[model samples]
Target: MSPLALGALYGIVTIIVMCSGMPIAFALGVVATSFMYFFMPASSLDTITQNVYEEIASVTLLSIPLFILKGAAIGRSPAGRDLYSAIHAWLSKVPGGLGIANVFACALFAAMAGSSPATCSAIGSAGIPEMRRRGYSPGFAAGIIAAGGTLGILLPPSITMILYAVASEQSLGRLFLAGVGPGVLLVILFAGYAVYRARKEYRLAHEIYSQGGIKSAYLDDEHFTFAQKVEMLPRVLPFLILLIGVMIALYGGFATPSETAGLGALLAIVLIAVVYRMWRPRDLMPFLNSTIKESCMLLLIIGMSLLYSYVMSYLHISQSAAQWVVALHLSKWLLLAVILLMVIVLGFFLPPVSIILMTAPIILPPLREAGFDLIWFGVVMTVVMEMGLIHPPVGLNLFVIKNIAPDIPLSDVIKGTLPFLLLMFLAIILLCLFPGIVTGLPDLLMGAR
Candidate 1:
């Protein structure tokens, strides 16, 4: 059969397997390995195995599991709760104070967690109750949490960025650094919108206040001693240390992405055990179990993607697709706009990992040939993937927020996300127009590296 014919068959089978309710890992692996065994040399099986192993064994890929573990550990500890309390206390006086705090806190947590579901679950659990209690609409609460959760991908140390770096043979450190600027920009935009909405709707000022809980002096209660306020800062110090240490290491070139993740995971454990006093020796078993479970799933999906990529290569599918795209003669920016739109649409049905793994092989070379900056493209791709996380129907973040705020209807969750979604789009547009926003940090970091 012609290469085009083989590629077409592979695509059709892939969609069928995915739509059949089978796990993506099994579907991708089964289809790819079956095709390779039947259409190519039987010995190709060895090559596929080697390829999968190499892909999974990379130093950069190590960051994924570590980040996952960090997120898991923090979720199970008081550090997350404490952080939420502090943010809530400070922002509660605004119009949509609770919802606005949810956006900022989620963004901060996203920088550390590097996973959307985890960020949504952690911050939503705390923020949702507070927002509802403060008289904010439940739909608005869930929607903000869901929308903010997308920062897990946009922020540095993002597992999605690490995965893309591996898939595209780009630098993990560079990708991580590149994400920082765009991530901050998005957070500012989200916060600004929150402030504007709160002011217009509630007529509040943009005043900054010190962080405090219900027990603080700002309330009707008696003020605590200076010693007590000073003591609370120490309770929050672990998180500050984790953030500062990771960013400093990344900037100073002291560690690779995986190493930074390992450090993060280590800090998370220490925070739980030492700072939160929640991690007893007995908790280790469940911690390890959860880590293994999540790690296994990620590795399985990754293994499948590798095998699938091999099959696509054997069929010359990516080559043909790249040729066809180049043949279109569209300007690079226009083609990217089309690709971004498609990604947003596909995101409604597929997880970001599946989308990136399946499409990166087909789409990347054409993007490179079109003279697009790989680093900028990686950042843009992340933003697009994040959009999928907050979009309708299968938006995992939305569901997470809903679970946190059970009283909120699904339709309300969808409606609340619309404004945040527009902000996300604006962030993407800004990044596209000024590629430096994504590349500047990476360039500086690489020089240090």
Candidate 2:
């Protein structure tokens, strides 16, 4: 069969298998292996094994598990609650104070936990109940957490960024640094929208209470004594310290990403034991198990997806597709728009890492040839993928919110994320128009590595 035909067949079969409820790792592995066996040389089979091994053996990949461990350690502890409490105390007077606090808290927690689901679970578990108790609409509360959780991937120490670096052969540190400008931009947008929505919602809530002849204490400001605000600091000090320490280690030339991740995980454990007093061996078991399970699952997906990318390379599919795309003589901006739109469509079904691994090798070559920087493209891809987390059909963050707040209608959670989803798109557009937003930090700090 022609390479084009083979590539087409591969895409169709893989999507079919994925839609059949098979795990993405297994689906990709099965389809890739089948194609390799039938169309490629026997030696290519050997190459697949070696490729999977080498991908798994990557030292950079070590950071993923360690970072996940750090996230799991904090997730299993009181850190989430404390972080939310501290931020909520400070921001409560702002419009939509509780919701706005959730956005800031998610951003801070994303610094420690690189996984969106973990960020969602950590903050949602604490923020949802409080927001609902304070009379925030269920959909609004769940939607904020779901959308805010996406910051975990766009912020520093992101596992998705690490995977992109590995797959694209980009600098891990540079990509991490590249994420900062866009990450901060998205946070501001989300938080600003949260405040606006909260202000409007608060007013409506008060009106409803007044009509019912009930005093609405929920809209009242939480007046914290200066001393009370000071007391809230200790609850969040450990997380702040970890966040600052990891950022210093990463951007200050103090440690590699892997080493920094190890440090963060160790500090998390110590905090759980010493500060939270959850040091018992039994208390630690769940964190360990959760970390191991999640780490293994991600690694397996990485390994299998690498195998899939290899198959595309062996068949010369990626190069052919790139050549075909370049041959279309499309304007650079138009081509980029098409590629990003394809990514958004894919996001409805695939997770971020899968989207990056499966598409980067194919789309990136054409992008580079079109004069786009891979580092900037990486950040753009991340922002696009962030939309997938809250999008329908398979938006992982939506499902996560559902699982956490089972009582909240899934439709409401999905509805709530619509505005934040548009905010993500705005961030993407800003990045496109000003590539400096994505590349400035990396160039300044990492020197265009």
Candidate 3:
């Protein structure tokens, strides 16, 4: 069979296997191994062993587990509650303060956690109940936490970015740097919308009560005294130190990504055990076990995807597909739009890691041939994947928020995310219009390489 025919067959088999509930790593490995056994030359089989060795031996890839460990340590610590309290106190005077605070908290936690579900669970567990008690709509409260949690992937120290960097053979530090501007843009958009929605809804509720002459008991914000605010600083300072330390270490050329991640994990463990005094053998064991479990899952997927990638390369399928795409001579922006739309659709079904691993090998060649910057594209792709976390059927953050706030109907949570979802698209538009949003910082800090 022709390579293109074989590639199409492999693609169909993959989709079927995944839809049939096979784990992604297993699905990829099964399909690739099957293809290799039946069609490819037996001599070409050695590539699988080489691919596994290369992927496992990667120093850059080491950052993934370290970052995961760092995130797990912080997520398992008291940092989430403290960070939320401090941020809530500071932002209490603002309209939609709780919701806005949730956004800020998620962004901060994302810097440490590097995973959306972790961010959602950590902040949502605290923010949702408070918002609900404060007379905020359940849907609105759930939406804020769910949408905000996506920052975990777009922000620095992102696991998705690490995977992309390794898959695309781009600089890990530069990709991390590139994410800053887009991440900030998304945060501002989400926070601004939260404030607007909060103020508008609050006004409507008040007017309704006044017109009906009904007595309403709304939860009032705590007015922390200046001294009280000062006291909250201790709860937050350690997190700030970790965040700043990791950023400086990565961007200042002081350490490689892996080294910085190790440092962050170490600091997180120390803070949890010593400063917070929340560490116990029971708590510590679970946290360590969870990190190991998650790290193994991710690493296994990476290894399997490497095997699949080897298959694609051996068949020359990726290059042929790239040439086929280029032959159409589609306008670059048009092609980019199509590619991103496909990514967004895939997000509804696949996790970000699977999406990046499965698609990057096929798409990156075409994207690079069309003169797109891989680092910038990585940021853009990360932003698009952020949408998937809140999208339906398989939107992981939606389920996460639902799990945290079970009383909030799934539909309401989905409704609350709609506005933020639109804002994500707007952010994407702006990024495309000004590629600098994704590239500016990286170029300045890393000098265009």
Candidate 4:
């Protein structure tokens, strides 16, 4: 078959298999192996095994597990709760204080956790209940956390950015720096919305109660003494310092990504031990077990995604698709919009890792052809994926919120996320209008990619 025919067939088959509910790794492997066996020569087949091994055995990919472990250790300990408390205490004087605090906490926690579901679980477990107890709408609390959790993959030390770096052969440090600006922008946008919603909702609730209607109480003001705020920071400072240390090490060229991750993981363990005093096997093993299982799953998916990409390339499908895309001669901006939409649709099904590994090669060529900066595109793609995480039917973060706050209906969680979802799109538009928001920090810090 021609490359176009092969590309169409491969996509159709892959989608059908993936939609059949098979594990993504297996589905990719099965489709790749079958396509190679039936459509390509047998002599080249041994390369599949070799490629899978080599693709995953990178020093850079080594950092994924360590970073994941770092997230898991602190995620399983009291770190997230303490961190949220510290931020919450400081934000006590603000309207929609809890909501704003949750967004900020998620951003800080995102740097540590690097996983959306983990960020949601960590912050939501503490923040959601407090919001609920203070009479904030359950939907509002769940939505805030579910939306905030999406930050985990956007901030520095993010696994998604790391995966994008490896796939695009971009600098991990630069990508990390690049993310800082847009990530902060998103945090601001999300928090500003929180403030807006809080004031509106609280005023409405107050008006109802004034008429003897007794509507729900909105925790409009959560006062805290300076001493109380300072006290919470002591517990939160260690993890914040760890995050700062790891980023400086990466950006300053003090260490390789793997080395930095190793140190970060080590420090995370020690902090949990000293601060949370979780030294026992019982305390650490669950984190270890969870990390190992998650790491293995991701590595498997990565290995197979490489194989799938190879199959597309071997079939000349990737090159053909790129050629086809470029041949359209559309404006780069229009082409980029198409690419962004494609990834958003993919995000509805696949996790970020699989999406990056499987699609980056095929899409980057066209993006580069359009003179687009791959690093900037990576941030834009990540933000779009963040939107998918809170979207319906398969939004992982949405389900995470429901799992953590069971009494909050899934419908309510989805509804709550709608506003933040709009904020994410706005973030994307801002990045497009001012590509500098995504690129300026990295270029200033590292002199551009």
Q: What lDDT tens digits, residue by residue, belong to model 4 across residues 164-187?
A: 999999988888988989988988
Q: Identify the candidate with maximal lDDT.
A: 4
Candidates ranked by lDDT, best first?
4, 2, 3, 1
Spell out the clash pairs found in candidate 2: none
Each prediction's total of clashing residue pairs, residues at least 3 apart in sequence or on different chains, is: 0, 0, 0, 0
lDDT of each: 0.78, 0.89, 0.87, 0.90
- Tell me the tens digit of each residue's lDDT in model 3 across 49-134: 77777876788888889988999988977789889988998888877787789999999999888889999999989999988878
Error of 1 at 385 (Å): 0.5
Kindly indicate the candidate among 1 and 4 with the higher lDDT: 4
Return the clash pairs for model 3, or none. Answer: none
Worst 10 residues of 2 by lDDT: 213-222
> What's the lDDT for residue 256 in model 4?
94
TM-score per model over all chains: 0.91, 0.97, 0.97, 0.98
Model 4, which residues run further than 4 Å from truth? Answer: 219-221
Estimate, for each residue in 5-116, the C-alpha lDDT of model 1 and write its tens digit. Answer: 7888888888898889898899999899889888988888888778889778878777778888887887666666677766666655554555567788888888877778
Any runs in candidate 3 off by more than 4 Å, and if so which?
A: 43-50, 213-221
What stretches of model 2 exceed 4 Å from their correct place?
209-217
Model 3, position 227: C-alpha lDDT score: 81
